[model samples]
Target: MFSIKSLHKIIFAISFTALFVVWQWYFVKSVFNFDFLARPILADGFCKDCNVILISLDNLRAKSLLCYGYEKNTAPNLCSFAGKSYLFKNVYTPSSKTQDSHFSIFTGLYPISHGMTVPFTSVLDSNIKTLPQILASNGYTTLFSGPKNDPHLPLDRGFERGFSYKDKGDEPRYWMDNMKKNNLLNRKFFAFLHTYRVHEPYIPQKENINKFYPGGPLIYVTRNDLCKKAYIKLLSQYPDRFKNLKVLNDDYCNIYRDYNTKYAATWNVEIESYLARLDPYWDAFNNLDFLVKKEYTHALYATSIYEMDLELKKFFNELENNKLLDKTIVVITADHGEEFFEHGGHSHAANLYNESIQVPLIIYIPKSKSQIVEKLASSVDIMPTILSILGIEAPEKITGIDLFSSKENKFVLAQHVTANLETIITLKWKLILNGDEKELFDLTSDPEEQIDLSIKNTNISNDLENKLNNYLFRLPKYNSIKSEPFPTWIDEEQRKKLIETGYF
Candidate 1:
């Protein structure tokens, strides 16, 4: 006989044991199934010809889009023009930051394999075969225009041409100069433009800022940018040696407690930045809608997509005025999305929550018609889909499936790395494997990712964990050994900038 508490404990112990056994059994079975990560033979690869213009909006959230059920009409140009585009309900990037996510986007490989898993890490391994590199070989005159952070320059990511992307206005101009010169060639090849409109500082002009921040879901974006500017300005004055900050966000909380102290003054100047005025509410969900109306929303990105949109609209009007809308495959996507206190986070990189990882994938299908698909796609698949669309054989080394061909989840994989280790996400669930602990979430039931389903669904979670661990193990090792140093995605120029700014 047992007391009530003891009886419950005994039952729990038995349940735990049973779950462990079931998980072990399923873990082996799933890992052995090679069809999960299959190489797709796309028939579309052999039957298409169109001008491809791939544009990625940085840090733009899917839920923010009007097409995806949000209340606001954020992307009117896209919603109205694109006919056969598939807006994948769940498309997650491997990592949340620009460096690793875009590296994965370009290579169809995981961050772990490419060694771009951490921030400020230098250029991706030059030898790694990338999407643009493969596309260039297939007669595409690959041209890209965006912010300096686009590819970190140098190796140029194999694209034939690269532009100097900056945070100042004129994002539209970045591509126009090239567009006018290559307008003829563009009719024959693909031109890519990636924009970063939603990265921090949501930096728009005073008039522009009022439209989104004076009562909205984007208030956080504007306020956060204001704080960052203030902080960065103060950090700029520090010695390079002390400025090398290891912590992702600031860690000097207690230092400013006593504001009257000399030490506090230094930090106060950093923290207490002043602007003319702040908007009513900066986090409005209708921020993009307001932007679309004003036309400066694209300029707020520091690179020009609105201008690009105007150019595109003008080009299309002229084309339809002459007849060429059917000949272009226009796509709009995001590397990752900005976090406006969604998970008590600021930038992408620290964690892999849905708001930060979920990106919009809309392609205004060329000549044909675009329709939204209810399938879950990964950013990795975008490159292969592009290759297939243009009738090109995807390179042998790539691991993405042609999404248009395979509408099912044979298991879409996503990974991310912070200071310690990496995490992996799948369709059914997400398994985060840090050194000593494992976090599991059943994404279907819990989209917010609030519950740790690992213990509750040990059998399924453990199986997912094994696959994630094994997948990470396959990434390229820097040293000849199994483990080496932590990842640093910053380039030499960026490193110098960091050093000068006292950010190690």
Candidate 2:
């Protein structure tokens, strides 16, 4: 009944439409990174009265947690929670420093965008809206608990903008007791709990330390102390190898000890006591093997993590006892991760490696089914995800997307501003650039990032480099406020504190 010429024309038209659709899909995906199969938002407004608890365990690496596949049961409570929560496997911080990473978490912007790229120096721009500000405006009481006089989260830097109450300590029990006393937990509230308990100068209880490290506290020196001893030993052993050999004499060591004594006088009682034990045995301490010291230091770090896990258990138990477990959404993550002689680095913020960037991200939503999410998430995504879960609108200028509804980011960017280092990571490849230096790693094959494939795989490396450059160039810059200059004594005290914390 159909004409042959008409049938041919119909077939040709159908073919042409199919070709156009294919071309459009490819063009949009390549040009704009369109995701055709993005998942819809799940359970919006499911917990309008739910309280939010954001817990940041400073310097906690994902690999050290049992939930993330660590061999030891370092975090039994977190592991159990992960079994019933959404565990994001590949979450990375935008920066390796405390202030920079936490700013990203609170503001939903990268360090470059938020203008806190330098640790303890660059302040957050006052114009930037934070997660706490948004939640507080929505009738949620906000509270903060962290270290007193924290240089990283200074009040002038906008950290104290939206909190109704703030505690200057890192004890969960104290915070819970205060909440009960004030009756703040009965109302809808957002509480941020931060602790350096897992951070270095790894000092756990003696029993906990002995569990992981059979070696006593004699071998447990701060990473900075160990580095100083190692340097002194290097000078003493290879005096002729250095141009300035005169400074390696016994009088020089005595002079250093005297200077430390003068400096310790300005510090608090606890740090002063710590310095007393550190300076007297430098010569004898330097005699320990570098490898042995490294082993013991790692053990101490593991022990500290284990103890922090116990504290977390107590905090959650109190929540359950108060009948608030089902009414709260708990998010546990870290500002950054710590490095243990990985890539010849002792601590963080000096490099953009995975050991310093990868952190744990666990979101516990009541009545939600537990699952592992393999999506690539950045610290910047945290605020948006929290707001999304609360059914609140995020700021219009935020660079992050909701982790639940949006497609996985094509690449995640990280920067170490002081180091002038930048990295771009995809699902399979990672490219790190420091000025003219470039290193590429196939993450799927070398998760440790030991192999540098930049030379052998120039095409892939160059492509990633181009993408990273484009991404950075497009980010909005903010006017960064510099922190006030500290007085000589205060400067010295903070310097000593940083040194003890292994930041030096």
Candidate 3:
């Protein structure tokens, strides 16, 4: 028993076992355990009979809403609703792309966990249970209404798993009329309404436009002609920069033509749409005045938001008329925010900047006190939060916490895998990591993220980078499901719709 060699082997074995145990604990805590200050109180069956409605406004930015401190009153109805709802001041999406972020919202998992980080390419893992599936299992009628041909949310692509009813269009009135006709309004239900009306090609009605932009109507023909003229002028002025500009059908006028002329009559064309189609020729806009472009785009976008607000007001009024308002819990949010050249990008799926990741989150719980919550939240938190309010238990492995609970997350993470960008954000500090590049911003002092303090704040930057790296590395080990390739069944017509919606 006192032999030296035998004693040495025992000590070695014990040391190895201890190290393995420690490593195992760290891996589990980092990957599966969502750090919370305390256990969330499960109010089981508290809202068992309440109806849940989740409205996702495609590409709607928080700053575009009046309640979020936008200069213009772009969404008056939503603002009024916010007065009686819980408005989250800082809610960030896990990804800037529509498909990825929506997947996170439905599964209560981040892009890395759910494996839908790529836009129009990555299919959600089959093993991940969606919120709709859980709600439907709990005796709730699940409904979905959105663009029928939306390539980002194809019914066959796991999105139609639990939906008992689905609409081919994104119109609220159409959805409501159908619900009433089907006698679904009286049941305990979970309805998800999504729309791209306020997205790119912002074409608000003439009346709605006049309310925001007092400058008469923005004639499409005139704007189209002007853009063509500007491009021509730029080609002649900056031959070197415009040498590779491609003209369609040998006519510059046809350069910005819709992909499908047959659908042009129904297609809402706008100056923004034309400009977006000029990708690869984005430099052609250099000849135009920057301030003019910004102002014009902002005005059009504002009008679109206002138009949606009016639609929402009508929808809410109908719910009240049907005596369903008091029994309904409404959750209003956006897939992600749109970027208007904030970081040299026109639309989303390009970067993880604040404009692309920050969105408004409003929850209207019947009889709950209305107040502005200053806590930081994420898109992944939506599923768990909704389930908690409905008194349903969330999946044990999810990364989201009940937003209403006293538990708080140390940080929220956002990533745009297509762009190879990732960010870890706290209430004050935000660290963006791209390959070896790093950017740290003090959100409290520089909410716009104008300055880079990574070099000056090395300590903070290093700490965040380490944490982010640890989390990312631990994910693959725990995630059993792998992302699948884009389905081949998506037809050419659907591809056209996706392009028209700026998802190309």
Total clashing pairs for each candidate? 38, 0, 0
Residue-level lDDT tens digits of model 2 in 1-504: 779999999999999999999999889878766644455545446666689999998999998887887778888887888888889999989988888888889999888888875434566777788998989999998888887556577655788778888876686556686566556777999988888887655657766677766646655444444435534644464445333334344344443444334444333322333343344333333566777656666777888888878888888889889887788999999999988766765557468889899999998888787889999999899998888888898898888878877567899998877667799998899999989988999899999999999999999988999898888889887777777543343347545645433332
Local accuracy of candidate 1 as per-residue lDDT tens digits, 1-504: 789999999999999999998897678557854333455333474336666767776777776666766565555665566544556667777666666667677777766666655333344565676665665566555566654322232233332223222222225445545554655344455666655445544554444433333432233334544444434544554435235443245433322222214443122232233211112123333445543423333234322223234444554455455344567666677777655444553445356667777888886664454566766678887877877777777766666677767345545555555434455666767877667777888878987778887788889877877776676566454311213242333346544433221112
Candidate 2: lDDT of 23? 100
Q: Give the lowest summed-lDDT range of ten residues in model 2.
A: 265-274
- Which is superior by TM-score, 1 or 2? 2
TM-score of every prediction relative to native: 0.66, 0.82, 0.77
Give the TM-score comparing model 3 with the true structure, all chains together: 0.77
lDDT string, candidate 3, 395-474, tens digits: 98899888877667789999876567899999999999988999999999998888999999999999999999898777
Question: In what order do the candidates fall by TM-score, top score first?
Answer: 2, 3, 1
Per-residue lDDT, model 2, residue 331, is 92
Weakest ten-residue segment in model 3 by summed lDDT: 262-271
Estimate the TM-score for candidate 2.
0.82
lDDT, candidate 1, at 346:
40
Off by over 4 Å in 2: 1-6, 19-37, 41-43, 119-121, 214-286, 483-504
